[model samples]
Target: MNAKYVKRKSYLNFLQRHKDKPIIKVVSGVRRSGKSTLFLLFKQELIDSGVPENHIISVNFENMAFDELRDPQKLYRYLKKMTTEESMYYIFLDEIQHVQEFERVVDSLFLENNVDLYITGSNAYFLSGEIATLLSGRYVELAMLPLSFQEYVNWHKQNDRYKTDEAFFNDYLKSSFPYALFTDNDQELLEYLQGLYSTVVLNDIITRLSVQDVQVLEKVLATLFSTIGSLVNTNKLTNTLKSAGAAISNKTVEKYIAGILDSLIMYRAERYDIHGRQLLNSQEKYYVVDIGLRQLILRDHREDFGHIVENIVYLELLRRYQKVYVGKTKKYEVDFVAINDQQEITYYQVALTALDEQVLTRELRSLQSIDDQYPKYLLTLDQLNKTANYDGIKKMNVIDWLLQA
Candidate 1:
């Protein structure tokens, strides 16, 4: 049974390395992005490492079985009562945002000498400023995401055989969520994704925010999702929605985007001025957290292949824990400015394909403009033979980049 679980090696390695430290491990991500599954795998790891079953307590707040403990006070009391005799207890709370004032409970648990706390929140509500104030300098926030293309491929290879490159391309477009590897029927997968999208919109956004104009919000979403990887702020978005028959103010649009952001449904990438070494004030790009969710809501996946590649590149940078930004050169734009843990900066230009000589040169121009010798790359759908260096910038196949650890 444990073998059936796909261990997210890098993420789990992070958790395992930080094991039993005096900090709460908080895994936050979009709904159904596999937070609970990761926690289960970690819990199983604990069991296999010879931890007594009685010493570990795991609860999912969404489960009806845990309904009685949804209250913060009751949950606190239940855990307090269960481990009265334990010396070191590992407590895992899944979807902890569903619990009222959960940060208070987490704070209380942190006060205990014996408790090692881990909680998962599907929305940004879990990591609000108040929680940071409550447990300052003491919690590990692991921003999890849906499975990567490599993870999906490995999962499928374990269960069935396939042509690697073909499978990778299929995953790049259709298999948007982690659960995609668990099912073969496309329609059923879309249905599951749609249901999850609704849940994210309703619970994490509308219901949680007490939004009245659901249609306006939907229109706002339509505007955003339709233009992923492009630049459009609240003002432009508001105007677009008004033209679409939903009259909403820029202020309202701002609020809606904030709410959308808080739900983890979409992420904003601010612009970095490569010349000035500062973040620009406007024209930030927005990326939907998962391609599957976009496919589920928009009903067409084939049209936006270029932006789709950009979006995939964005998430891959995030998965690798790189600090990413849209790079602004003097006269051209770099697709991404990725700074790793070592503070090394690199510029990347992402495109669907640069098979044509003109297109290849166009893709390389921005990186070519940067005179400093930081690593610059041109990434596309071109195979190895098709990829070649231009003026010291490395040309790589996007699929090859995604497969790398």
Candidate 2:
């Protein structure tokens, strides 16, 4: 089945805003989160705006045909030779981590006046170590993710039945990877997720980290995946695995978790002390990159739908904010504290349902504890009043909040 690509306007807008600027455009995301497709869409937009096709030089290192070009010198020569015209040449390199010393190629291209460089990678570490120091402030990174709930809803509103809850259920159950849209059935989707998960683990994690014990790594992943939205520390995780029959050290567990985070399979949110105005170096929470992948890894995770909803809310915050943290007051905890590019802050509390008076009060207490007057929100699945305000705090349906642009 041919997959219809939804125009990811947010990411596309980022590219359009940075078009032909002196800075390099770097797209980073988990594998199959539509990095290549985003580049393709932006390239098409350039062509539509009258940029000649021959001025675009695109290469995916994953393709065997580009095997020889994996050498930094050959790749540099090829790109240099491609820029024959006096106008700008748009160059996109996909999965560039496959190339050794890719920073050199990227650094060399940045010096050319007529070259506009854009690159994509599945591993976050590719931007660390050498490339980071080399490119310092020379490039801007547009971190990408799989489709948001709004994206899912917009894409399926006309093609399928648009029951709000059902649509969300389908998106949550099937998978959020862009390619999952073309899958015909549950079995096909599961197989696709399995392959995607294996690729991330085998290629991005195990092989990249030189980890030898696959079973231990699987255990670490299972533990982390099942505990999304909960505080985790390496020592505790090591103890838990030891009791469960896996013999692993705390350092090893730490290394494996670092590998997992670097691979973009999961994200860590540090605790921020709201009153102290500083980050607390205590237990940090981990959220999986995609909820559907969580489901696949922990089949029995249906029991914690509340945390699942929290996980979804966290991912949405990530897409909307520059920095997200688990907010901590002197006496209470807020679900999320989002800070934007303008340095504005927002506090959020997520719950599966706040219909019960007790649950509602409990959820509100955290946001109320924050003394600052920054915008505060309480997001829940409850739809009774749909929208309401509590002491200047806005309470709205999580689904509705997600759909907001």
Candidate 3:
């Protein structure tokens, strides 16, 4: 079955903003994260915006027809044949990493004043080393992530108008990926996600890094997935792996973690120095790229609402383009410290249900400890009639905040 593609509003806005810039547009994310679909969407938008069909050229390296362009020289020659000096050209290259010495092709293309280039890659190594050196100041990266919770909700609302808590929960479990929204079958989606995960682990991580300890790397990833939202240290990860009979060193653990981060499978949120008002250097929290991937890795126990709250918080920060961190005060800890170019905001806590008096008190105490006045919020799953505002903090339901935001 062919999958229906939904237009991503955020990516479209990014393209419109940079349409006239000379900088190369680079869209990067994990495999099957809808990068290719976004490229096609942008291409359509360009055509609609009056870019002639002859002026826009797109090549997917994964396509069998372009398999011969694996050589840089051959790829450059093919592109040269399609482009002309009379008119400006828009070049969209998908999975450009498959080409050997891709930086040469990019550099050659960039030298031409008539071409505007856009490229997509599944891994960060695609932009590393020679490419970074060659196109140092000529590119703008547009990071693509898995479907945000808001996008996820928008996707399901298309088929069903009546949204009950149970229905939304079922949709959340099923259509976590943008691609999954096209299908209703759960088992088939799980199988596809499993295959996609294997490709990322094998082709993206292992092949790119060329590591001998595959088992150790897998163990590290599994550990990270299992311990999402917890503050993690390299030494502690090394100790845990050693205790599990993995025999991996702290340095190896650190390198493996970096590899995962480079692949965009996991993001590490650093600790913030609240007193000094700066980002701290040590002990950070890691969130998986998608909750579905976490569920795929850890199959049996998937109802970790605390981790889900963490995931939502991480996505919210990304959406707002906030510099987020785990915040600590003298008395208590804040869940997030979101700072942008202009303002600084502190977030307090998250819980699945704050029905209990003890849970409510515990969640509020974290926000109350902070001396400064910023927007403090307690995100909970409970849909209470009244919103309690203590001192300067506001307590609201997570679903309401997500929908409203």
Candidate 4:
């Protein structure tokens, strides 16, 4: 099937905002998350705006057409030859981290004044290590993800209306990988998710780290997927796995968890002690990158709707804010602590269904306990058109909140 022209406006807007800037535009995300498609859309936008075709250069390292340019020196020489001193050259390098010494190549390219560079990579560590020092302050990183709920609704517009609760339940069960939009059968979707997960594990994590005992690593991932919104640590996970017949050490478990986090398969939210103004190391929460990946990995994780709701809220917060953490007050816990570049804070509590008074009270107690002037929110599945404020906190339906933007 041909790739759909799903215009992810948020990411495309980012590129447009940074257009023609001298700094490198680094697009990093999980595989099959529409990174390549975003590049295609942006390239077309440039051409539609009357930019000359010959002035633009784009290449995917995985393609055989660029096989000879896999070396840093050769890639550098090729780009240098294509670049000119007059008009600007727009360069898009897909999966550029595959090349040897890619950091040196990008650093080398940043020197030319007439070229604007954009590159994509699957590994988060590629942008985290010495490359940060090499290209510090010379680039802006735009982290992309699988489809958001808004995009999910957009894709379903050609067929069923995915806005209703029944339709959203099905959407929630999906991995939201852009490619999954082309598949309808349950077995086919599951197989696609399985293959995608394997590719990420085998190539991105296992091969990249040279990890042996792949079975144990998968078991670790299974444990993580099953408990999306719970507090987890290496020691507790090792004990849990030991009782389940997987005899892995805490140290090994720690390494595996680190690898998963670095692979961008899942994200960790540290506990921030609100009143004490400190970070606690003991019980950090983990959110998988996509809910569909969680459902596919766990096979029958539908019953844990509460954590699934939390996972969605966590990812939405990430997409809207620059940083997110688990907030802890003296007596209660907040589901999410979102912060922007200006250090402004927003506290949120997410619950699946909050019609019951006890559940509603519990969800709001944490946001109420925090004595701050910053914005507070209570996000639940209860669908009431709400413009009301409760004890200085905003109460809104999670679905409405997600689709608002």
Candidate 4 residues 223-256, lDDT tens each? Answer: 9989888888778899989998987898889888
Residues 25-76 of candidate 1 have per-residue lDDT tens digits of 8899988888988988888899999988888999999999999888999999
Name the candidate that leads on TM-score. Answer: 2
TM-score per candidate, in order? 0.96, 0.97, 0.92, 0.95
- List pairs with backbone clashes in candidate 4: 175-292
Off by over 4 Å in 4: 1-3, 158-166, 384-388
Q: Which stretches of candidate 2 lie over 4 Å from their true place?
A: 1-3, 158-161
Ranking of all predicted structures according to lDDT, beginning with the best and ending with the worst: 2, 4, 1, 3
**Superposed Cα deviation of residue 333, candidate 4 (Å):** 0.9
Give me the runs in candidate 3 sitting further than 4 Å from their true place.
Answer: 1-3, 160-162, 346-348
Scanning candidate 3 in windows of ten residues, the lowest lDDT window is: 1-10
Candidate 1, pairs of clashing residues: none
87-118 per-residue lDDT for model 3 (tens digits): 68999899999999998899888888788888
Clashes of 1: 0
List per-prediction Cα lDDT, in the order shown.
0.85, 0.89, 0.80, 0.86
TM-score order of candidates, top first: 2, 1, 4, 3
